[model samples]
Each structure stands twice: as C-alpha cells, then as structure tokens.
Target: MANTSYTRSEELKEILSGQETQLQQKMDEAKDMASFLVELVDTLEVTMSNRSAKGDKEKPLRYCTHIMEQLDALGWDRVTLVDQDLSRVQIELCDASQRKHLITARFPPAYPTIPLTIAPLEVPECEDDQLASQRGLSVGGLSLKQGLALEAAIRQAEGQLEIFREFWDVMQDFDERTWVIDPEKPTRADKMRRCALGNHCSIQVTVQPLSPRSMPDTKLFGPTASIAPMRTKLYQNAGLWDVKKLPRENLEVLLELEGGFPSPVSTNKDDINVGCGICYSFRFEGQVPDQLCSHAKCQQPFHRVCLYETITTSAPKT
Candidate 1:
C-alpha cells in the first residue's frame, strides 16, 4: 500500500512538470507574434504619414500661392506652373489675351537663396528694320518649392526693370525735300528771289528722278545728264543749298537696269536671262501657262511674239 501511494505521487509530479513546459512554450510564441505585429504597425504608420505629410501637398501649395501673389503685384495678369524640379520652377506668365511669357526661378538645393530667369515666350519681331533680340534666365540645384518662391519674389521686386537693348542699326527715315527735283527753270534772278523770301519761302518740288531718255540703253553723259546738275542748279537758285533739306515723300523708281533688250528671234526658247526691278531672276520660256506669274516686276521686256506667247499661255489659266 505504501509503495503504491509513493509511485502515484511521482507520476503526478511528472505530469505537472510536462504541462508547465508546454505552457512556457505557448507564452514565448505569443510574445514573438505580438512583437512582430507591433513592428508591422510601426512601418505601416510611418509610410501613411509620409504620404500625407506637409511636404507632399502643403509645401507646393504654399510656395505656389506666394509666387502668384508676387506676380500679381508686379502687374502680371496670370501665371501658371508648367514644370517643377529640384532647383527650378518653369512658369508661364500670360496677359489678358493669353499671350504667354516664360520665366524660371533658380534656387539652391538646400534652398533659401533664390534667383530668377525671365524671357518672353514669343520671339519679338524686329521693328523699324531692327534686328530681333533675345532675353531670359538660368538656375542651379534647387527644390521646386524654393524655386517657386524665389521666382515670385524676383518678379515682384526689382527684376521687372530688366531691359534688352538691341545691337541692330537704327532704320534711317526716307528724305523727300532735299531729294526732290524742281521742274521750274532756275536763274540768277530766282536765287535773289529765294534769298529775299528766306524762311517764308516754299518751293514747288517733285519726287520723280529725271530720266535722260525714254528708252533703255540710252547713253547719259555729264553732270547735266544726271540728277546732280539739276539738284545743283535748284539749290543755287533756292539759296538754301547750305541747309540741304531732305524731302519727306516716299520715292522709288520702277525702271530696272538691264544688260540689253531681249533678242527678237533667239533660238533658245527654253530659258531667258533678264534683270528685273530688283536683283531677282525670272524663268518661264517653255512651260505651261499656269506656271507663270504676271507681276509687273516679273514682266521683262521681250519680243512681240514672246510677249504674246506669255500672255496667251498664262491668260487661259487665269
């Protein structure tokens, strides 16, 4: 009986020890799972926070608004952000009619030191026969937010004073008074009359250049044959030669200087070489009528038959 009791007690001890070992293992596994879950939650939270942080939307919005206000203060009607980079923002400024002007703002990669570049979106046309000039900016490594802010500040401040000076020559105005011809004969008596009239005198003048002959290939000799003699005589008569005033009327001669008249019966009908009002070439000998042009400058003096052919061929097409 005594032995039986002792054996039963030993068996009970062994069973209890086995159960305690199993419980410890289960607690360790649960702890490990809880730690893993905590780590996963932390990583997820960080990622979500980053997505909605101020840097993503708030920073860009803030910078853009500041820039826009600056542009408005500088008399700009509209501004748009076309592109953004680490060190620059490409902006387009527009007027009421939607004409755009491009500008760039440069900033440091670390930010704060903002600079600007501005240029017209459309190329300025050369006016008054002047050459077209280009203007604009450059940048360094800068954040988009910094660049936007910088650009706005630049436009609002003293940057608007920038001007582009063209290196082109100034167009000369056409003179008419001194360049005109006098039709009336000048005599020593006319000179005396002009001197007496002085400031109150107005002479009759023509803008035409006198021709020595009515036909081409006519020889013009001496200063008298040229306009020089006529100008000299008129100046002496007017008593205003010292002033040598110029005329204001636009003057141009339609006559073209050619080598000679076209041959009446040239063998080559395929082509003809002739000079026009300006230094331009015209080629139409054996082509269809539709290929020819009938501008006054294009019509070179030709033989009667050639002229007829040209008219006949082109008239049908017209």
Candidate 2:
C-alpha cells in the first residue's frame, strides 16, 4: 500500500495556502476597521469644529437657544429655562392631534451624545385599566404595577431629545407607546429581519405612527434619515463590504425603553453590491426589471442577458 501520509502532502499544501489567504484577509479587515474609526472621528471633529467653542455650561445655552428659536417659530412663547445650570427648560408644546402638553428638558453636562433628560410636567396619570389607554404605558408592555412605579419616570426622562429636537414631537412620543420589534422575532433563522428601513429589531426606532412618509427612504437609498447619512459615510470610510452593519444597537435598545424614543437607523447605508446570482458577476449599472430581484428579501441584480441564457440552457429547446 502507498504511504498515505506522504500522499497527503498535496492536501497539506492546499490547507496552508487557504490559511495564508485567510490571514491576508484578516489583516486587510483590521486595517480597514482602523481606518474607518479614524474617519468617523474626523467627521465628528468637523461637526464639532463648526459648533461654537463653548464651555459645558455655555454649550447647553447655545443648544437651548437654537431650540427656543425653533419653538418660537410656531408662535410658542412659553419656553423658559428653569434651572440654574441652564440645563433644564420648560416648554408648552402641542402634539400632532393638537392636544396641549407641558414638557421639560434637562440636559446632563453631556447632552447630545448622551440623550437629554426630559419630562412631561403635566401628563395625567391613569388607572391600571387605563394603562393601555395611555400612549406610552400600554405599548411599552408595562404591567400595571410597573406603570404605577414609573409615574415618576413617566413624568421625566433621560431621552432622545438630543436627536429629536422638538418639544411637541418628542413629548408626543413619550405619551404614545411605540411598537418595538421583538428581538426574538426571527425574520431569518434566529435573525429577526432588519426592516426594509434597515432598522434592527432590538434597536428602538420611532415611526410617525401610520404615516406614509415613513416608507423606506428609497428602494436603493434606504432612509433619507439624518442618522443614516452619517453612518453610510462611516461604513464607506470603513471600506466595509456591507455598509448596513449596525454598531449602535445596544445603546439604542436601552434608550428606546428609557425614553420611549424611536430608533434611528444608526448604521451603514443600504448600499449593496448587486451581482447576478446566476452568472456571479456584479454590476454598478444593469437593466432594472430583468437584472434585479423584485423580492424584498433578495435583491441582487443580474444581467438580463445572462438570466435569459441561463433559462434557455436549462430548458429543453423546442
């Protein structure tokens, strides 16, 4: 019998080659990751540079002033800073349905990066049975006991006001419980589907309940959202193959429950390399209807000619 050990040299060489290639891939990925993080810091730095160079106390003042100007445009004269630090403010805001609400905002020494603290100065408390009738309490899945315990919490929040800059808009969401995708809701084999909006199940995303404008940003662009643009730029900077990778799910999930805020898609953009699943080649431009998968879940675009040829070869010629 031939020496099997010596004969397996070819297999060993193949294994070694595969490992070398994998090592190179890992090196490339590491380099890319580092580059991406630097680019992200750079973007943040640019945004920061554009901001007024103010001390912590002054920074909150400018942000509040910007906010006040916005509120004043709506004929609101009730916004007032009530705190010595200028971190807290009281505003009279009206919701979409035009119901009046008294909202308060208190920013930590760290404001935007960490959500601002907010409270509804005057939202009415409800009976246990009325928990469901209460916008936030019912949908938040709070037990009556939990809801009652949160009366203090209901009155206040460390919230998403940093992103959602309007009193009425933010306060209304505080009152209305938002639908959270069950993290355990599996859309694809223990992976709950990221929304066509590119939102993850665990992340808190605010939807303007029943609004048509909330549809996917565009078939190709995803959401025309404030957060998505920055994330897309980050993903591109990272040279990540899939730009839609979510990095902020953990923080977002907590903020959602804490503040009843919606999740913004803090992730890479909806840029996918569309390749022919048949011929296995990608294209930046291809025939729209024939090249693209119309199916929502699978949207790789194929060469229309390649697809027709594939069909012809597989089927018996008449």
Candidate 3:
C-alpha cells in the first residue's frame, strides 16, 4: 500500500509541472499582445498629427503669399493692376520698340495645379480666324491647355510682344502723319484706320496683322467724280507697293497725292471737322457724321440716324 501511494504522488507532481509550463506560455503571449497594441496607438497618433499640420499649411493665405512672391520676382513695375483677392492681375509688357501691351490673367481656385486664363486687354475688334488661332497663349513651351506657373506665363507674354511690334509701329506712323477721322481714340487693337484726304474725301484701310506692309483692303468715301481718279490710280499703281516702306509712304506713291496726307495739326479745323449738315453740329449725340450725300454738287455730310430719319419721313405715301 505504501508503494501505491508513492506512484500516485509522482503522477500528481508530473500533472502540476505540465500545467505550470502552459501558464508561463500564456503570460508571455499576453505581454506580446500588449506591446503590439501600444505600437499601434503610437502609429495612429503620429499619422493624425501630420495630417492636421499639413491642412494648416495649405490654407488660402499660403496660396496668396506664394502668388505675391512670384509677382515680386517678375518685377512689380510690370504689374499694372492686381485685385485684392489675387484672382485677377493685369500685366503691362513692352516690346523691343518700347511699345506696351496689356494682358489680363485670371486664376482659378486651384491655380498652379490648373492653368490660368491669359488674354490681351485690348483684342482686335475684327480678328480673323487665322489670327485668332495664333493668339493662343503658350507658356514655357507648353500649350495653355496644360498647367502654367505664373512666372512662365509672364515670360511667354514678353516674348510674344515682339511679334506684333511692327504692326503697332505702322499704325503709329499713320496716326502721327495723317488726320485720322475714324477711331478718334485709337488702341493697340485697332487694325483699321480711316484718314481724311481733304475735300470731304476719306480713305479707309484695313491692315494685315501678320503682313503689315502688304497691300491693305482699301475703300474710298466721297463723290464718285472725286473717287474715280483715286481708284484708277490705286489699281494702276498697286504693283508699285513696296514692302520695305512704311504704310504712309506706300499710300503716297500709290495715289500720287499733291501734298502728302494732310497733317492733323496744320489743317484748318473748319474744313476737316465738317458737322452733320442736318444737325448742324460737329458731334451729334456723341457721333460724327460718317455718311455723305451721294450727289456730286451737294456732297452734304449727314449722320446715319439723321439720314435714315429724313429718308423714312420724306418718303411719298407708300
């Protein structure tokens, strides 16, 4: 009986040792799980902190500051106007001839990431499709369809200013040398110029922007008796037009005028400034009389509105 008790005691010791080993393994697993949980919490906290800091750094004020820095680099003098919001900016670009052109740029809310819209402040009133297509803004060798930074767009505009310099120079020569009757206030965008040629006669010419010295589309206004000679001379001398000469020079050679185009400063105001015969005022309702009587003897100038009113009222009972 004592031997049996010894065996049972040994079995009891073996069972207790196996249970202790299992308990130690369970404790170690719990420690490892606790360490894993602490690391996960730390990772989440760092991620959230970084995201909040990034959100604060990318606010609208930051965008405005970035834009101002770029404009300051481009020279503040070139910037003619800028709105308070920094959404719209007007920049004045000068050509090789010292002639200036104004361009307006509009930024979207997502600017720099999205391309800004750039357009000339004064676009031609009658732009042909070909010229219009060539005017698209190309920034830093990329089409405007792609994203453009502020500095790149400004630089591109500066280069483009040189392309139209000749055209503006020709128009300038016309204004300074001749008495321009139409477009009393001329802008860089004007492609047409009408000059008074004494005796109540005028000639309108539309210049080609790409080829400024080429023969322009010409139309003469006045009595046929007076215009017939000018028309015949223009056609006969069309081939004499010299591309190397200025527009005023070409016209003088083509029409064979007695005196060069009449100087606005030297000409008598009474002869050049013919008021509407109907209204008897130099300017009627802010409009100069552009229409003239078709008769050769009485080439009375009248405003379009005045002539229309007279014609409609004077019509015999239709």
- Model 2 regions more than 4 Å off: 1-30, 34-55, 60-65, 74-76, 80-86, 92-102, 107-117, 120-318
Best by TM-score: 3
What lDDT does each candidate get?
A: 0.30, 0.37, 0.70
TM-scores of all candidate predictions against the true structure: 0.21, 0.23, 0.70
lDDT of candidate 3 over 1-318, digit per residue (tens): 111111224423322333444333444554465654464346445544653455433435545776788788888998999976677888887878887777777765444434578764453443455554576532222133224677788787676566667888899999998888777788887889988787767789888776788898899877678788999999999999999999888998999976888877768656764567887764666687778787767887788888889889999995
lDDT by residue for model 1 over 225-276, one digit each (tens)?
Answer: 2334434444344332221222211111211112211122321322332212
lDDT of model 1, residue 46: 60
Q: Which candidate order results from sorting by lDDT in descending order?
A: 3, 2, 1
Model 2 lDDT tens row, 65-99: 64455445534465644565556666655444455
Candidate 3 wrongly placed segments (more than 4 Å): 1-59, 121-146, 280-291, 308-318
Which consecutive 10 residues in model 1 have the weakest lDDT in total?
A: 191-200
Superior by TM-score: candidate 2 or candidate 3: 3
